[model samples]
Structure formats: structure tokens, C-alpha cells
Target: MRYLVAALLLASLPVFAQTVAKPMNDPKTDTFLRQFAETRRFMSGRPTKPRITPDEKTVLFLRAQPTSATQTLFAFDVATGETKELLTPEILLRGAEETLTVEEQARRERMRVSAKGFTGYDLSDDGQRILVSLSGKLYVFERATGKVLELKTGPGVIDPHFSPDGKQVAYVRGHDVYRLELATNTEKRVTQGGTEAKTHGLAEFVAQEEMRRYSGFWWSPEAKHLAYTESDTTGVEKLTIVDVMRPERGGNTFPYPRPGKANAVVRLGIIPIAGGKTVWVDWDAKKYPYVATVTWKKGGPLTVLVQNRTQTEQQLLSVDAATGKTRLLLTEKDDAWLNLDQDFPRWLEDGSGFLWYTERNGGPEVELRKPDGSLAQSWVKPAAGFFGLARYVDADRTLYFYGDPNPTQSYLWRVRDGGAPEKLSTGTQGPAHEQFAHVAKSGGLSVATTQTATTMPRFVVLRSDGTRVGELPSVAVEPPFAPNAQFFQVGKEGFHASVLRPRNAKPGVKLPVVIKVYAGPTTTVVRHSMAENLLNQWMADKGFLVVKFDGRGTPLRTAAWERTVKYDFATATLDDQIAALKALAEKVPEVDLARVGIEGWSFGGYMAALAVLKRPDFFKAAVSGAPVVDWLDYDTHYTERYLGLPQEHPEAYEKSSLLTYAKDESKPMRPLLLIHGTADDNVYFFHTLKLSDALFRAGKPHDLLPLSGLTHMVPDPLVTQRQYEWVLGYFQKHL
Candidate 1:
């Protein structure tokens, strides 16, 4: 996938200790693919979604047991570094099987959360209570008493939040916003009108998929009113996907905005906690229709970031809670487009100023802005490798962020109220080390997650003085073997690529090459984490040299470099991969470049099919999974950002489409395999069908595999194993 990867392996056994695999041409005694699937690509049992308590005394996180995707809440004491489990699904369900509503399933799919049982939680302001949602029911786990109670909520609830004072909880049910008083157990509907065409308090499709705004509602301080979104999908396109395998089960139909099509009309409103008339927030809806993000905090006014339909311009607006009026704090405009950074506009507790990260200065920099929106201080100089704000402690007047000189790695950096930025997480062994520091709001308590080329991932506790506390524990199942790979900068442009040869290959033996290409703007494939290379190693051991490349259009670079493929995705990225492959052939001769096969999924899958079609001399075969054949068929936000609206830039869409090449009967076609899930909503299965239809009309032969009961992400372990085997087998027969 372009936005995601095929396999995510963060934890592994002590196989990195060995420089090479034992014995020549040796196959792992235990199939790495089997362990990978059974362990959920080693993502199970990994600690995630951590929250630091207000007192800086504890850090709470959610984790599952080994080989399990069902998670539970846990707390880590900062003082003694002692860990304790707070709640489990087994205890809460009481032998009853946890069930999810269709709404909950769709919400998890949008959030990319495949895990079950406490996928997320909300920590109460005072740190005395924790709120979790399970099987569509809201539950509060009292920290002091170690008790869990279900709230008096109606069915089909998602995206639950707590009132600032921790006295009440609010959630969305049946497309409308609702609140429940914790003390009295009273439930009140905040909004009255809701339907399938119009919804309240939940994010729209593009907001969650492209803009990264998950929640459609925000609560004002003191729990006086609720600010929420009302989306009207009256004229938006309604698409349906059939349950082809299980015809009796039916399908799903929802609003999906295609390129140049009408998007859901979204507007904001504020309603009292006791349920009264809503005061709609006013803005220029025609100019800035996209609400990128919203924030309503204690010391700051109701703030929101709104963007234009094309995403070329955005404005930070400060809302008046009483009057429901807004004032433009700042306006940002770019020639190409603006990439939304979710961490920006962080409000300070004193209400003196806020931090804003903008690329208008050529690179990303954290600038402290006054209440009037003028710059007060620039915290860090503009860096091309700027990741984003990690943790901010307004009480201590300090910030911890992730950035590094290398784009393939992220390191933790710290800055105080007046001092310059300091590089924390010292003792780095190599450039492949990545660090993320989760600091408490009160003080300098940080849980640093550090991953090196040698280690999987380790979470260590640290104090303000850089004193070692202890480690946050994990029960991730280790893999049978480590990836035998080498990462380096290939070609003059320093494009990041990794080549994993068979661990048991001899010095002079030549092997076929398989290029794993995900060359899309949404993902940066070449990272320091071992999680990215496990699948590459498995492919290498299948008697092929697995090579991966992150070419042009990948993020974490200058706008000039990334926008090279602005209107033409088919030319620039594919050219970069071909050039890099030529350079690699000269650097390492153990792999035969002439026998190259390309494979990818989603946008990567588009490139895989393009490589074999457009460059038949370079790539012998391809395996394209869920590829987007036409940019015009994709969503509005992601597609319009690069190629503009289909109405204006029709040539760009024509040039970037895979069907354009597939229709050319004059070109020599290469062996190709197309795989897609019939029920895929995002990059729907119709994409593959279109390509196959075009190929058939062009008298070209190709293979197709339609998976049933799967979406864009095939989360089933057994299916993943069988699918990979089929892919490997296909390459062996064709390449």
C-alpha cells in the first residue's frame, strides 16, 4: 500500500546478532512468513497510544499479549518503573463475546486500527478516570478503585470524549452527538436532526482518509458547550461495493467524493450541554470548505484550521464560543499545496501565545505566535527533516520533537523556554536509530522509544537530568530470523534504497531481482526500522534479490524535490526507480538486473503494473494488488493535491492513468498479475476491473484474483500467508 506497508515487524528475536544466516542458502527452520502472519506482522503485543498523566507520576498505554490483536489498558509508574495491567476484555466481557456494530467496524477501518478490545481511550483531565469504548459501549475505568462501569449510552457509539471537568462524557450515536452525565447517569441528545444523508459529530470520509482529522467534534473548556460538525452529503456520489463472494450478505453504500465531484458540505456549530438551539460558527464556506483540524483547550479560544478545496491555502481561525463568530488569526498560501501538520497551533496554558509549524519559509519550523498572530519566537530553524511536534509541556515551558538530518531516521530533540534545541537520546550507534519521546505535561518525564538497526524497539524512561528510570515492557513475539539486508544512498540524488540478497548466497552466484516499489507521495518506504525489511528478506530467500526504493514524490524532503511528479506520476517516479536500478547493478553485481520483477499494492501497485507495461525491457513481470488505474477515480483531497481537479487538468489525469498504457496494443506487454479485494471501499475493486477490461480490449493477457470479505487491508493471517505464497510462486514461474 502507498499509505501503508504490507508487513509491519517492529519486534524480532536475537537474530541480528549473527552477521549472516547459518549455513549457505539456508532456509529458516521455522517459516518466517508463518510466524509473521500468526503474530500479526509482529505488530501485536506492541505498546501504543500512550498518555502521560498530569502529575507526571505514571504513563498509561494499551497493549495486547503476544500473537493477539486484542488489547487492554495498562499503566506504568514513573517513579519505580513498575508496570501493572488495569483492565482486560476478558474481565469486562465476563465470558460474553465482544461484538461490534457496523459503524464501529467502519470507524476502525478508517483509523487503520485492526486490533480489538480497547483500541483507544481518553484520559480524564484530573488523571483520576479513564474512558474506553468496547463493542459499542462506553466504559469508565476508575483509576483509584480499579473498577469499570458501563455508561448509560445508546447503542452504536464512536469517538467518545470526556468533559474537561471529568464530570460527563460525550459520544456520537446514530449519526448525532449525545452526552451522558457521569454522576446522575442522565443521557441527553445534543443535536436533534440526523440521517443517512446528513450526520453530526463524526468525521467525513475525506477528513479521515486524507486530511487526517479523525474527530468532528470538540468540547469547550468548563464543559459549557460542544462544538461539532454537521456534514450534509446531499448530492455527493453514493458508491456501492458488492459482497461478491457472499452474495446473500449484501453490500455497503455511502458518500464517496471523487475528483471534481461535489464533497459533503461541512459546517460547524456549538450547542449547550443541556441541549438547546445550536449557534453555527460563521466562515467563508465557499473559500475554505475543508475543516482540517479543530482544537478547543483550557487557555486558548476555540481554534480551527480551514483549507481551500484545492488545499493551496488555509487559515487558522479563532472562534468566539459565546457568539459563534470566527476571526482569521493567520492565512497560509502555497503555490503547489499545503501539507497539514496536525501538531501545530499548540495552545500554551497561559494563553500568551501558540506554536505553529509552517513551511512557508521553505522548510518546516516551529514558530511561537502571539495572540494577534505575529511571530513571537522561532523555536527551531527550518529543517528539511522536520518530522513534527512530539510532546509539549506548557507548565514547564518546554517541548520535545522528532526530527533528524537523515530523512530515513527520526531522533528526539528538546528545547526549553529560552535555550536552543538539544539533541536528546544520546549514544546513537548509527544513522538508522529512530527515537520518539513521550513527555509528560507537568515536567520532564519522558518515555523514549528508541529503535536501532540492531534492536527491534525499546522504551526507556528518562528524567529531566537525563537520568535513567526504567523500561516500558512489551510482550511482542519474536521472529525466527532477522532480515539480512543492506541500506544505503543509491545514485547521485541520494535516493534511499535497500537490497536484501539471499542470506545463503555465494559470492559469485547471480540471482533474479525483485523490486518492491511503493513510489507514491503518501509513503516513505526506506526507513531505519527493521519492521520495513522483514518482508524483503523473505522474498530474497525465495531465490530472488529483493530491492526496495523510495524515489521522487516521497515526503520528508524539500517541496521542489517532492513535487517533481506534481502533474505526472507515471514518468518521474518510475524514471527514478529505473535509474537507481541501473546504478545498483554497477555497485553490486551479485544480482542480475535483466531479470527484474516489480511488485506493490495501492499506489505502489499502480507503479508495479506501470513498470512492466511501460518498461518491459527493464521489468520482466509484475504483481499489482489493488492498484488505482485512474487518478480521476480516486478521492478528491489526495488526487486534487497532485493533479488538480479533473475538470481543469484532464491531460494530467490522462497522462497519470494506467489504463492509458494498457490500451496501447502497439506496446510490448509484460507478464502481469492483478489482485484486489471485492469489498475494498478505498481504491475500490472496480479499479482492477477497469484495468483488466482495458487489457482484454487491447488483446493483452493478464491474471486476476479477487479476494472476498476483505477491504483495502487484508488483516487475516492465513489469507496473507497464502497470498504471499501465490505471489512468490507466480514470480518464480514468470520472472
Candidate 2:
């Protein structure tokens, strides 16, 4: 299999994108674009979402065939080092075409799942049953017998999960929660009075989109009781997204709360899965409206994380399932918006203690607490690059995690309950590459994706003794060439950045440059991974030097550096990008300042547009994709966190908005190309229209390319191929 993967990488796939993008002058770039789209940026055919069985013997994961977007479930036995097919989407659907309900489609969109087949699966606590949902239908795979059975349920089954005992499966359908008894093949409704406006066992839009809490229900340790959220989205504003290219299909209306608007009134409740009275968990909903996270473990209380509207404060409340009462266990506050750690309240099985992560002392750190929530020990000093726990081995009471010693690289580490931290991942000496570990619940087996220098991601299974068991094979096609980026730092503060020069360019000749920027919080652009620089190299191959840098607002840095962008997205970000560019130009003479352009998508799109308008003298042209014209048009949780409530801080909204600079006659706009999807629900299509309207009114020289029947993600191969061609063409023409 390894030989086959290597052979396939050396071989070539016929170009399909050229049929659509044949008009481009550079055939090499056109072929690269075609391959990039077909391979999903060379991301297809990679194993993902590996679920290690409870016994720590088998590893279950999802992978697709080479150059395919569809994925299938497979299992690997640790002892035999052999992999076998568990389930395939083709076999489930047979010859019929699969259909996704609107709710499921929206859910996948929120999760950013672009693949076609089984995107996710849930394993029973005993590891006997595997529950998966495809195209609104539910199925369970029995491990012992190797038999797959379809659970007879209503249409649009969402978030189906097996109970702790594995005898039953519970899911939300038609705004209500239902449980299916496996033995009798019977289904029972657990809740009543569910409507479109009041959804039971379904997460609200903001919670799913911003808070990263996808499921609205969780089963108890014994599987007797279930906790769920009932959300009332009555007063929230509705945004109707329509595919303008096909208007006859009508529009999709969804509850979308803007900044300062009414949010979903979500209430927590505990109800018996066997059908009984409901007990509502008591909390101050008016004060902390965001139900961030909920955790229920064997020896711990049912703790829920709640955040205030402004996200400046949050609290961890423990709820008594029987009495429906709550107690505040911990509180975290920040002068600006608080950054959350998803992995917390990790309770130990012996009921001795649990782990809690916080940033109250400046950066992220973890603390161990006793059963009563008293601090037992501070695990480590605040590490800015500390990612959440990968796993907690209950038997040994050790925690496995991924953390970065510096900004550009990350490694997997393990720390026993009372011992110091130890690095589990290797390749610590060379240029930075990402390392991730997934230790089994039983603690003897672990699967890690560890890379060094310029290698593709390889999922290697390792033993507890630090010996390799085997590698999970990947048929993912390699890029046309390795993206060997020149990694360095810029500015006096040493901001992380990378520059990619044309491979065949003359040393003395200067190259036109494109500064690709996505300097947003929670993400750092410049990394040591070769895969991270593929697009930059692709652009550089087209006779342009591509530069990318993580400015002050990017993560994996000091909290003070990220907080600088708070309430002011206009000046500080642009000034930092300019400073980084000027500093880079001082070091590399090949950086041609006379021909500089900028391009980005989403938040970066907003920045790109802001560049040409605010600093036209620096950026000659820009290609802004799916930009937010005004901060007021964005969603509530994200916008309000950075730029306060629009009602209270109107000046921040006005200053951050592209329309503000577009309307300013003193700041002249340069050549710009605006690309946006007509069906974009995140940063809606209204943004481009609004910005284009303002620019038109101001007599600005710019171009607008509207993608019909598309969303925020350009998943369609033809569409993305055309976008690359247009982006390069616009920059080449203007510069």
C-alpha cells in the first residue's frame, strides 16, 4: 500500500479544470489550479477523524480514494497491523442518489464539511456499535457480526448518538428528541411541545457557528437520563439566502442575529430517556446567554460553561441533575473578549479531581481541581501556544496534549497527574512541522501525525513504549512541486512570516509580489509546514513573489499582541502588514515594491479591501474575496466580541467598515477586484453589493465578479479554478 501511494504520487492525473480554464496564458498555473481544485488543495485521500476503540486494540478512521472528495470508514487492528473496510457510502446508498435535508446541509456547512460520504461517526461506549448518519438517514454497524442495519426513524435525523449502554440511540428530528430501542426496533419521543421556533435537542445558530458546540444533547454516564437544550429563536432577525442563478428554487430563511440583536433563548433541561418529568437546569440566562460547553462524566457533576453577551466574562456552573440547581465552580474574565478552550472540566474517573483551562492570568494554562472544585495544583505556567487536551488516560490518570514551545511549530506532550510534562512527538530539531497525538482510552496504543521538514502528513500508530506499530496509508496526491518557503521574522518585534520566490527566476531580477493576508485572531498564517506554503508557491510560480505573515492580531502569540485589534480593525492591522512588508523588502531585494498587490478570503478579504482604500500608495491592487463591507452585517458573537455592540460603539463599526473609506473622497481607491458568492450566508452577498454600491457612488475604479449559486466556501472545482485564474489575471494586469 505504501508503494502504491508513492507510485500514485509520482504519476499524474489528467487535468479536468483545463476544460474550463483553458483560456489562461500560463499552462503550468492552469494545470496546478485544476489539480488543486480536484484534490481539494491536495487534501483528499487523507485519513481523518480516527476513533480508537475503548479496548485500545482497533483504530477506526475515514479516508477517501485518491483524488476523490467522498470518504469511507475503515478500521485497523493494532495487533495484526492490517486495515479492513468497515463501511462505505456507496454501499449504503446503493444505486440511488443521496439527498441531504436542509438542516443537515446547514449543519455540514457550519462544520465546514465539504466531503460527500460519511462525514462523521459515533462509537458506542463498549465499542460494539458504530452509529453514523448519511443524507438524513441513520445506520448502526455492529462490530462483532460485521452487519449493518438501518434504524427506522423519521426524516432528517440529526446528531444521532448511541447511549452509554449501546442498547439504544438518541437523535433530534423535526425539532424534537427521540430514542430508538435497538432490541425491539421501537422509537419513543422523549419531549413534547416542539416547534420550528422552539427547537428541542438542537443547537442554536450562534452556538453551532461561533461557540463550537455542535450537539444540543448529551447522554448521562449510565444512559438513564439525557440533558438537552431547548432554544427559542423567536425574536432573532431572519436572513433569507437565495441562489440567484436558480431563483425558482426559492430562498432559505434562517434565524441570524446581528450585533446587538436578540439571540436564541436557550434553556437546559434533564429528562429521563425512559419517559419521565423534565428538570430544567437553573442558570442566570439573562446575564450569561451563551451556553458555551457542557460536560458530564462518571465521577463528576454536570458542568456547563456560560458566557456573557459581550464575551468579557464567563462562568462554569455545575448542575444537580435531580434538583435542577446549579453552583458556580469557576469564573474567567477578560478586559477584552475572552478566548475559550474547548477541552476543559475533564473529570477523572475515580472522582478525585478534574482539569480546568483558563486565561485569567494572561495566557492559557491548565489547573487541576479536587472534586469540590478546589485547586489541587497549577499544572504549568501560562503557555500561549497551549492547545487543549488530546486525551486523558483514566487508568493511568495522565493527560495527552498538543502544545507549541514557539509560534511556528507544535508537538504532542504527555503529563502524568503529578509528574512533569514529557514530549511524545519526535522531529524536535529541524524546521517546524505540526505534530498531533490521539492516545487510546486504554492508554497502550496511540495514533499520531508527526511531520518533519517538507513531508506530507503521515498517520503513524505508536505503542506506549514509543515504538512505531505501523502507519495509516494515505493516497493523497502531492503538489506539482514542494513549496520550499523561506521562513524568517520581520519588524523589531520579530513577527513570523514566509516568502516564496519563483523557482526558475533569475537572482538579480525583481518579481511582482502578492501579500496574501489572513491576520485574524485564533489563526496564524506563517507556519513551518510545507503544506501551509503550497498556495504561496503556486502564486510564486506564476512570476510573482508571494509573501504571508502573522501580524499582531494572530494567535499563538502573547495575549496583549492579539488584543491590539480589539475595537480597531482598521489602522493597527494595515500598519502591521505594511511594516512587515517594508521590513521584508529591506532584507530581500527581490521584493518589488513598485508592483505590490494583496488578496484574501473572508476576514482577510476585508483586510485586502481595506488596504487598497486606506493605503493605496502601498498596495497597487487587491483581489478581495467574500469580504464583509460593514461590521454591522456580520453575525453577533464574532462581531460583538471584537467591535462591541454596534448600538454602543457606532464609531468602531463606522471605522472598520469598507464603506467608511470608500465614502471618504480624501482616500482614493486603487484598482480592485471584488469576488463574492451570491448564496454566501456567513459574510452575505449583500456585503459585496453594498461595497460595490459605495465604490460606484464614489467613482472608484474597481471590478466585481459575482459567483452565482455559491456559498462562502468555493467548493466547486470549476468555480475555484476560475477564481484562481481571475485573481492572478487581475494582479498581473494592474501591477
Best by TM-score: 2
| Minimal lDDT window, size 10, model 1 | 10-19
Score each candidate by Cα lDDT: 0.82, 0.82
Which regions of candidate 2 are displaced past 4 Å?
Answer: 1-24, 27-30, 426-429
- In lDDT terms, how accurate is model 2? 0.82
lDDT of 2 by residue, 157-236 (tens): 99998987889999999999999999987889998888989999999988888888899998899899999999999998
Tens-digit lDDT track for model 1 on 1-735?
A: 210111111111111110111223223563777778878888688787778888888989999888888999999998777899999988878888989987677777788888888899999999999999888888899998988888888888889999999999999999899999999878899988977788999899999989888888888887989999999999899998767546687777878999999999999999998888989989998999998989998778999899998898999999988788999899999888888887778888789988888877766678889987888988776663568677787867888888776777888778888457887764447765554667777656777777755557767777877777777788998766677667778899888887888888887688899998899986787777777677778878778888888888887777677778877899989999998888887777877877999999999999999998888888998999999999889999999999988888899999999999998888887888887877788898878778877877787877766666688998888888767876887788776
Identify the candidate with maximal lDDT. Answer: 2
- TM-score for each predicted model, relative to the true structure: 0.94, 0.95
Clash statistics: count for each candidate: 1, 0
